[model samples]
Target: MATVVLPRSLVALFPGAEHRVEVGEVGSVSGAIDALEARWPGLRDRLVEAGPSIREYINVFVDGEPAALTTPVPPRATVHVLPAVAGG
Candidate 1:
C-alpha cells in the first residue's frame, strides 16, 4: 500500500478527510487518486481535470520527486498532493 499525504486545504473540503491515507496495490499516481476517490467522493475531480490530467492548480509528488498521473508508485512509497502556490 502507498501512503498518500493530502494538503490541509483540500482535506478541509471533505469532511472526515485524513491527512494521510493508505491505498492498496496502486501502481501509479492515477491509481492512487482513484483509490482516494473511492474513499472520499469528489476527490478525483478536485485533483484531476477533464483531460484526466492533474488540475492546473494542483501538484503531485511521489517520494519527494515531482510526479504525473502515470508516474510509477512503488509499494510503500509516499505520495503528496498539494495546491500550486503563486506570489506577486
Candidate 2:
C-alpha cells in the first residue's frame, strides 16, 4: 500500500477529510487515485480531467519526486498531492 498525502486546501472539499490516505496494492498513480476515489467519491474528479489526465493546476509526487499519473507507485511509496503555486 502507498500513502497519499493531501494538501490542506483540498481537504476543504470533503467532509471528514484526512490529511493522509492509504491506497492498498495499487500499481500506477491512477490506480492509487482510484483507490482514493473508492473511499472518497469526488476526490479523483477534483484531481483529474475528462481525458483522465491530471489537471494542470495540480501536481503529484511519488516518494518526494515529481511524477505524472502514469508514474508507477511502488508499495509503501509516498504520494503527495499538491496544488501548483502562483505568485506575483
Candidate 3:
C-alpha cells in the first residue's frame, strides 16, 4: 500500500478525512485518487479536472518528486497532495 498525505485544505472539506491514508496497490496516481474517491465522495473533484488531470491549483508529488496522474506509484511510496499558493 502507498501512503497518501492529504492537503489540509482538502482534509477540511471532508470531515473525518485523515492526514495520511494507506491505499492498496495502485499502478498510478489516478488509481490512488480513485481509491481515495471511493472512501470520500467528491474528493476526486477537488484534485482532478474533467480531463482526469490534476487541477490547476493542485500539485501532486510522488516520493517528493513532482508527478502527474500517470506517474507510477511504487508499493510503500509516499504521495503528497498540495494546493498551490499565491501572494502578491
TM-score of each: 0.96, 0.93, 0.95
lDDT for each residue of candidate 1 in 5-68, tens digit (9 for 90 to 100): 9999989999989999999779999999999999999999999998779999999999999999
Error of 3 at 31 (Å): 0.5
Q: What shift in Å separates residue 10 of candidate 2 from its native position after superposition?
A: 0.9
Per-residue CA lDDT of model 3 for 1-88, tens digit only, reads: 8999998878999988999999988989999999999999999999999876999999899999999999999999999999998889
- For model 2 the local lDDT of residue 69 reads 86
RMSD in Å for model 1: 0.7
lDDT tens readout by residue for model 2, 9-68: 888888887899888779989998898888889999999998879999999999999988
Candidate 1 or 3, higher lDDT?
1
**lDDT for predicted candidate 1 compared with the true structure:** 0.95
Better of 2 and 3 by TM-score: 3
- Over 4 Å off, model 2: none
Which pairs clash in model 1?
A: none
Best by TM-score: 1
Name the top lDDT candidate.
1
Q: Which ranges of candidate 1 are over 4 A from the true structure?
A: none
